[model samples]
Target: MGPLYCALISQIAIILAFAIIGAGLKYIDDAFDEDRFSKKKAISIAPIIVLIWICLSLFDSVSATILFSILFAVLLTGKIDNLIFKVSTIALISILFLTQMLNLLWIPLVFLTLMGVADEKGNDYVDNHATLKLVEFLFSYRFCMKMGLLSLCILTLLPWLYLLAFLAHDGAYESVRMLGKISVAHQRKKKHTIAISPTVNE
Candidate 1:
């Protein structure tokens, strides 16, 4: 294959890797939240995942780096009470600073961070409150970050490929979340059925 073809393959691989990791993380979080997974196991596994995520970010473009950092920050903020999340966030931040992956232009970083925070808050609000269908759908998938990234791409401030990668990550995250919800519901139904079933005397 030509060099161009090789490079394209590499980029696609990275995007797919990000999608897998995103899905895995979402599954872990959901399992833990539903008490299907123990805190000790999640805590033990978190650091490894954080390290892998940071290493993958290094292979990605600036846009991905900033977006991932914003995502980590949002997660930390939301789960401030969780020890594993706090440690993971601290480790990520420290590594990003040490590696200088976060030394981007301040204006865009600030703008994107604000947009990300707004999206996180809006998503939570829409989850609990009835709202317009369109607004709920947009926030459900955290479209604010996608919209921000697309605007930057249009302005030639960011690469288009990174935006596509971000979408893959978000899509995988959502898919895993939906599957987790379904699994939880199925488990509840099974338990209810067992509870109502009459036992046979041996």
Candidate 2:
């Protein structure tokens, strides 16, 4: 009964962590709306999301955790508009690959490359100054569509993998502290939001 109770609590905490991550990403999405998708901001979010996945992996199926990492790679690579962006994307991919290997790297690489190329080509729908328009369009439709699809795939696979693997085993209490970290993050965001709102209002 104690193990079951801990598992139930841990699962709820995991779900809430994901919900907070979604909220945090939605905050980024709002920022993207304001500045129209700054490449630097987008690149930075990738590692943060990956860190979240790494934390979750402690309590999730190996397959689901790996899928999360792959999706992180694909989504992060979409925002690359400069050398720094490419380098960061490559570094993250390499880390994930070296740590997790081919089973976890190949399919995401395929999706990343395909959707990235498509984004490069779909630059005609946003603005008029050719180069600027291309940048805008890449962020507007192509990145959004491709990343959205990949996120959908990750969400779809999570439950089945969890059931099959039964990751909420006895060691789950070891991971509950992750929820505290996420809560701290939320508090930080709240403080930042409060700090910035006054300036914006002024």
| Highest lDDT model number | 1
Whole-model lDDT for model 1 versus the true structure?
0.72
Cα distance off (Å), candidate 1, residue 148 = 0.5
| Alpha carbon lDDT of each predicted model | 0.72, 0.49
- On residues 1-202, what C-alpha lDDT tens digit does candidate 1 reach at each position? 9999999998897677667667656756765666654467666667667866777767664644555646654864474445566677678777777888754546556667777887888888998999999999988776777888789889988778877877887889889788777777898999988877765322
Writing each residue's lDDT as its tens digit, candidate 2 over 66-182 gives 335434544644644445435545665566566674344344434544554555445433443445755684554446434534563576633442322222321232133344356
Give the CA lDDT, 0 to 100, for residue 20 in model 2. 43
Off by over 4 Å in 2: 36-48, 62-92, 101-202
Question: How much does each candidate deviate from the true structure in C-alpha RMSD?
Answer: 2.8, 11.5
Q: Indicate which candidate wins on TM-score.
A: 1
Error of 1 at 2 (Å): 3.4
